[model samples]
Target: MKPNGWIIYNGNLPGNKFLDYAEMIQESATKQGIDMKILKNNALLSLLATDQLGIVQLDKAELPDFVVFADKDIYLARQLELLGITVFNSSKAIEISDDKIASYQYMATHNIPMPKTIVAPKIFTTGNIDHKLVEKAIEQLGLPLIIKEAFGSFGEQVYLLHSLEEIITKIDAIQGKPYLFQQFIPSSYGKDLRLQVVGNQVVAAMERVNINDFRANVTSGGAMSVYTPTKEEAALAVAATKAINADFAGVDLLIGPDDKRLVCEINSNAHIRNLLDCTGINAADYIMEHILGVLS
Candidate 1:
């Protein structure tokens, strides 16, 4: 007996984790006596509007049984929703998780502990980057601040400024783009925990440590290690995920001074390799199970 649904992936076919997970899901479904097909977004786009609905494509004319978004492609996900397809994490969840400042506000509103931070406007039109704005944030949140580009992945455009001089230099470089000025949580020591959440449950976790650099992203030469999170840590991770309405998410937490924990960032399309390697859990399998359950 063949199953009736397909697993839609949001990335290219080869050399990408998204594709890797797609293959894993297909294999898992095969074991469960379910028929599964892996399709890319581009391929899915071509078959849209037809009865033979393609599972993978950028433009989905008809609703699929389930769709997995790789990054924060909210517009496409919403389009599929309009077609009556059940998206794993709705477009609205992705939007909130993608925006760093918005996530912080959401967490704070929910009484979740988070680092004190400020969001600078997207456009700085005064021809003068307000030093006071940064200074005030520092005054309230304290020094060793982190200035981050609002929408970046794999630690590409994050700047860690240890001194006021560095902050000025980095702010000047990013003249007119929205960014965040957040107080650095020193306890992380260039390391943080990336916890996986599914259906608002914290399923797996890993500690990413960067010994040579300040950024703890695996792509940026960080080492991953397994760490058993405390009860408080796990609770916070789950709460943060729920607050953002993320069906599947990578939640980053920084251990702050006084042995406290602060929810730093939430990633919509979290990397599966690092967490799989660290925790020895097949994240792909977990995701597929959740998707299958939803469709069933």
Candidate 2:
């Protein structure tokens, strides 16, 4: 029997981007003769009982054979797995990818090349900045470095520090939040490569460039174009994704001072719209194909 699937997306998000992701996947699944449903995560509740564990929905029906989880709600994903439904990207991978610090830790453990980094000490409260810890990081990564909050996306919580005040302002603003400091790769100042990996291969790649900002994220005003990744770049991206135990991911890479590839970041629930627009390749098709193949 052909498996029935549900594409779960976050309903709390204000914009349509999250919904758009689920729709794209549903469309791809449809084209391949697989039946799929788009369900908002909020529509169901994950609950645990003394002797039972399952997801509850108001208009509840049978559980899907597989779930295409396109949100950061790890608990819900894990809850589904507990009931025997397979979730793409898996909860462990989603947990690691959702937190930049955790992602970096996994990357470092596997010998992935990246910029020099320093994890900030935990501060449970605000208004008290740790000067010594901040200074040590600056001393190691140097001035004009990158400060990235451990749990952010779209380049919104990332900053390039040039002076004491800028660093202090950012630290103060995000105090009590997990974050990190890293060396800035000037060579890749306004650009990076985004490679979409499915299973063990890279299906599509793009180079993003921003003339106005240090961040090269498309949402941060970066322009994108289709690009071919070198063998080494491909290997690094594939390795980085696997290191974090992600089934599929969008791996960002930077060109280091030594002209070698350095891992910038990995996105577990990477939006495929941009990749499709830039490369005219729908990554959703590849994702659905991978899923169907695995199940088969």
lDDT of 2: 0.93
TM-score (C-alpha) between model 2 and the true structure: 0.98
- lDDT by residue (96-140, candidate 2, tens digit) is 999999999999999999999999888777458878777888889
Full-model lDDT for every candidate = 0.75, 0.93
Q: Sum up the clashes in candidate 2.
A: 0
Q: Candidate 2 — worst ten consecutive residues by lDDT sum?
A: 124-133
In candidate 2, residue 2 scores what lDDT?
95
- The runs of at least 3 residues in candidate 1 whose Cα sits more than 4 Å from the true structure, single-residue gaps closed, are 1-15, 44-63, 124-126
Q: What lDDT would candidate 1 get against the real structure? A: 0.75
Per-residue C-alpha lDDT of model 1 across residues 41-141, encoded as one tens digit per residue: 65554235756543453544444465666645576667677667777677888888877778887888999988787887665745676777767877876
TM-score of each: 0.85, 0.98
Q: Give the distance in Å from residue 267's predicted Cα in candidate 1 to where it truly belongs.
A: 1.5
